[model samples]
Target: MDYRLEQDLLGDKNIEVSSYSGINTARALENFDLGGKTVNLHLIKEIALIKKAAAMTNKKLKFLQEDKADAIIKASEEVIDGKFDNEFKVSAFQGGAGTSTNMNVNEVIANRAIELLGGAKGEYDLVHPLNHVNMSQSTNDVYPSALRIAAIRLIRKLSTSLSSLQEALQIKENDFADIIKLGRTQLMDALPMTAGQGFGAYAKAIERDRWRIYKVEERLRQINLGGTAIGTGLNATNRYVFMMTDIIQDLTGLGIARSDYPMDITQNCDIFVETSGLLKSCSVNLLKISNDLRLLNSGPRGGFGEIILPKMQAGSTIMPGKVNPVIPEMVAQVSLRVISNDTAITMASSMGQLELNAFVPLIAECLLESLELLDRSVVLFKEKCIDDLLMDKDRCLENLENSLVSATALVPYIGYDKASLVSKKALSSGKTIREILLEEQILPIETIDKILSPNELIRTHISGK
Candidate 1:
C-alpha cells in the first residue's frame, strides 16, 4: 500500500504523489490521502457528545459494542481532559472534506485507547477507525459540528474579555465624574460636558454590544450535527439529531440545540455571517472609543490639550522629550484588523453557492482569528489605555473657559444675537467669554456666572456627575 499515491473522492486528480520520509512526508501523505484528519479535535468533541447522547437514548450502533465503546469513550475522555492535544496536530485546512483530520483523530484515539487497554499502537484491527470508533458518523456532520462548538467556546471566552473591558470603563466614568470639559462637534467646541459623560456613553455602547453578542450566541446553539453529508442522513439513525444536541448541551454545559430545519442548517452558512456581523458591530464600538481616546489625548502643548494620556514610551530617540499614545494606537490597529477580518468572513459566508457551504474552513479561520485578536485587544485597551488615563483638570477647565461655546448657554439670558455678539468679541480679543460678557456689560455678572460657569453649564443639558 503506497500511501503517497492515494487519491481523494473529490477533485484534485492532478495531484502528484510525494514519496518522502519523516514527519514532512507524513504531512504530505496526509494531504494526499482522503482529506481531513482521522480525528479532528472538534470531531472528537462531537463524537463524545454523540456517544453521550446515544447512551442516554439506548440507541445501539452495530459497530459500537460494550468493550470497544467503553475504550473509545475513555479515549474521548482523555481528549476532553486535554491529554491528546499534541497528537491531533493536522491543520484544519486539509484536503478530502476533512477526512484526514477525522481519520487523524480517530487513529490517535484508537492508539491511545489501545495503550489504555494494554495493547500495541496501530491496533485498529481491534478498535477500527471507520468500523467502531466512527460508527454512525461522517466528516460532514462531525466537521461542522466541531467547528460550531469550537466557535461557541471561543466566543464565550471573548465575551468575558468584553465584559471585563466594559466594567473598567464604568469605573473610569465614576473616577472622572467631576472633570468638566468642552464637548466637540465636528472637532469644534460645541458645549460643556463632564468627562464622565463621555466615558459613560462609551460604557453604554459596549454594554449594548455585549447584549448583541448574547443574542448571536443563541444563533450558534442551533447546530446541524445529524444532517450527515448534505442533510441526507445516509448513515445515521433518525434518533441521532436531537439526542446529539442534548449530549452536546450536557458536555459543554451550554444551551446548544438542534435546528428544526436540518437541511437548512446543514446547507446554510448564514448563521456564521450573522454572528460575524454582530462581532464587527462590537468592534466598531471599540474603534469609536479608541478613536475618541486618541483624539482626546492628541496633544498636551499645541493641539486641543484638553486631556493627557498615560505616556507609554519616548516617542523618538532623536527627540529629547516626546511621548506617544502607543497603547491606544495599538488598539486602533487591532480594531481595524478585526473590522477587516469581519469583511473577509462576510465574503466567505456570501460565497457559499451550493447545497453545502465549502467556504466554512475559511469562515472558521477568520472568525477564530478575529475573536482572539479582539479578546487580547480589549484587555490591552482597558489596562494600558483607558485604566491608566489621566485627566488634566486645569487644562480642561482652561480650554472650556476660553472656548466660545458658552454662547449657547446664554441664549436664555442675553438672547441669541446678543450672545453671538459676546462670542465674536471673546474670540477676536482672545479673552474669556465670561470676562467679555462682564466687561462689555452685555450681561450682568450673575447672569454670566449662571451661563458661563463650567460646572453650571455642564449640569444644564448634560447629566451631572
Candidate 2:
C-alpha cells in the first residue's frame, strides 16, 4: 500500500496515501489500539456536522474564507452522509476525553476538503485541520455536543422501533382478547385473565418508556456546541457561538438549542446519565416482557405451554423438535447488557473532576451501543415472536380450570372461610372449584358463571367494578 508522511506536535508518521485522516488520528491508532475498537460512525458524523455548522457560521462572520468554509462544509457533509467511515480509528475507550476522536474527524474533513479543493491529502496548507476545520471549537464542547446529537438521532430510532413493537404487541393483545388464561403470582396460578390483558400490559410499558425517551431527547436538546475549551466560549466570537447552533438545528432538523449556561452543560454529563437511565428503564421493561413470553412458551407438554413463540431455531441439537423462544431470549440478554452499560455510565458520569468529564468517551460509546442493541432487539422480537405468536387455547383453559387459586374469585361472594372449605375439598379430591361449588349448591349458576368469566374478573381488577 502507498503511504504519505504526516506531522503533528509529536512529529511525523506514515499514513496510508489514500486515507483522509492525518497525524493525530495515526497517533490515536498507535496509542489506543484496544481490540480494534473505534468510535461509532454515527458519532463521527455528528462531529462532522458540528464542523460543518461551525465553518458555515464562521464564513458568514468572515472569521473564515468562504471558499475554505465551503470546502470544509462539503467535506463534512460527506462524512455526515457516511463516506470515509474507515478513516475514524480512535477507540471508544480512550484518554483525552475524546480529543483523539475529535481530531480524527477534523483531520478527515480537512484532508477531504483539500482534495475537494484540488490539493493532495494531508496538505494542511490548503485546509488545515486545527486552523480551519476546528477554527472555533474545542474537544470539550465539540465532543459533548456531538454526543448529544448522536444520542438524539439514536433515541429517535429507538422510539420508532419501540412504537412499532408496541403496536405489534397491541395487535397481538387484540387478537388474544378473549382467550382465557390462568394468571400467576409468585410463579403459581392465581386467577382467570385474558391473554390480551397480559400482552396489553407489555404494550403499556413500552408506550410509557417511549414517552420517557421523548422527554430525555428534549433534555438533550440543551447543548454546549460553541463553548470552546471550558464553556467560556473562549477563542470563539459571540456571533459564531449563537449562530452555529441555529445552523446545526437547521441542518439536523432537531430541536437543539444553545445551553443557558454553557458551563453547566460542559462541566456535567448528567444529562447523558438521565437519558441512559431512561434507556435502562426500557431495558428492564423488555426484560420483564420477554421473560414472561419465555415462561408462557416454556413447554409443549410439561411447562406452561400457554402460548407458542415463533420457532426461530431448534433449542438443542440433542433434543429433537425443540423450538426455542430465541428472539425473546435475545431480547433478555440485550436487556441485561443495557443494564450493565447504564451502571458503567453512572460511574463514568461521576468521573468529572473539574470542567470536563474525561470518561465521556465511554459514556457515549455505551449509550450508543445500548440504543442500537435495543432498537434492533425490539424489532426482531416483534417480527420473529410477537407477530407470529400463537395462543394455546386448550392449554390456557385447562390451566385455568385446574388452578385451585381460582377459589379466590369465589371468596368475594361465598366468604373466605367457606371458600377455603370448598378449596380444601377440591384440592383433596382433585376436583375443580366449579365442580365443588356445583355439588355444594354454593350460589346461583348465573352468579358462578359471572364470577368465573375472565373479562369480568379483569374488569373488576382494573376498574373495581
Candidate 3:
C-alpha cells in the first residue's frame, strides 16, 4: 500500500495515499482504540455541517479566499452527504474531551478539500485542517454544537415514532372498547373495565412521552458554536461569532440560535442531563407498557389469557406448539437499554469539570443510541405488536364474571355491605357473582341482569334505577 507522510504537532505519521483522513485522525485511531464503537455518523455529519457553515461565514466576512472556502464547502457537503463515512475512523470513546473526534473530522474534510482543489490528499499547503477547514472554531465548541444538532435531528425522529406508537394504542383502545375485563390492582382483581380503557391509559402515557420529547428538543437549539476554546470566543472574531449560528440554522433548516451565555453553554452540560432524563422518562413508560402488554397476553391457557399478542416466533426450543410475545419482549429490552444509556449520559454530564465536559463523546454515543433505539423499537412495536393485537372477548367476559371485581358495580345499587356479602358468597361457593346474585334473589332478576351486564358494568357512571 502506497502511503503519504503527514505531520501534526505530535510528529510525522504515514497516512495511506487513498485515505481522506490525515495525521491527527491516524493518531486518534492508534491512541483511542479502546472501544470498537466508532464515532456516530450523525455527529460526524453535523460536524461537517458546521465546517461548511464556518467556511461560508469566513468567505462572507472576507477572512478566507473564495477559492479555498469553496473547496472546503464542497468537501464538507460531501461529508454531510455521507460520501466519506468510512473516513471518520476514530473511536467514540476517547480522551481530549472529543478533540480527537473533532480533529478527525477536520482532517478528513481538509484532506478531501485538498483533493477537490487539484492537490494530493496530504497537501496541507493547499488546505491545512486547522488553518483552513477549522478556522474560527475550537473542538470545545464544535463538538458540543454538533452533538446538539445531531440530537435535535434524532429527537424529531423519535417524537414522530412516539406519535405513531400513541396512535396505534389509541386505535387499540377504540377497537377493544366493548371487550370487558377484570382490572387488577396489586395483582388482585379490583374492578371491571373495558380492555379499551386499559389501552387508553397506555395511549395517554405515550402521549405524554411524545409531548416531553417535543418540548425538550427546544433546549438543544441554543448552542455555543463560536465560543472557541473555553467559550470566550477567544480566537474567533465577533462578526463570525454572531453570524455562525444563523448560517448553521439556514443550512440545517433548524431553529438553532447562539447561546445567551456562551460560557454557560460551554461550562455546564445540564441541558443534556435534563434531555436524557426525558428520554429516561419515555423509556420508563415504554418499559411499563411493554410489560403490561406481556402480562395481558401472558397465556393461551395458563395466565391472564385476556388479550393475545401477535405471535412473532416460536416460544421454545424444547416445548412444542408454543408462541411468545416476542415484539413486546423486544420493546421491553430496548426500553431497558435506553434506560441504561440514560444513566451513562447522566454520569458523563455531571462529571464535567470547570471549563468543559470531557465526557461529551460518551454522552453523544449513549444519547444517540437511546434515540435511535427508541425510534426503531417504537415503530416495530406499533407495526408488529400493538396494531395486530387480538382480544378474547369471551375470555375477558369470563374473567370479569368469575371475579369479585364486578361486585363493586353492585355497590352503587345494593349498597357496600350487601355487595361485600355477595362477593364473599361467590368466593366461598366457587360460583360467579352473577350466579350467586341470581340464586340468592339479592335483587329482582331483571335488575340483577341489568347490573351484571358487561356494558352497564363498564360504564363510567354506574347508577341503580
lDDT of 1 at 285: 89
User: In candidate 1, what are the lDDT values of residues 215-277, reduced to their tens digit?
Assistant: 678778777777777777777777766666776788788888877776787668887888788
User: Top TM-score: which candidate number?
Assistant: 3
Task: Report lDDT (Cα) of residue 55, candidate 1.
Answer: 35
Instruction: lDDT winner between 1 and 3, please give it.
Output: 3
Q: Which 10-residue window in model 2 sums to the lowest lDDT?
A: 456-465
Off by over 4 Å in 3: 412-418
Q: Tell how far residue 261 is off in model 3, in angstroms.
A: 0.9
lDDT of 3 by residue, 200-222 (tens): 99999999999999999889999
TM-score of model 3 relative to the true fold?
0.96
TM-score of 2: 0.95
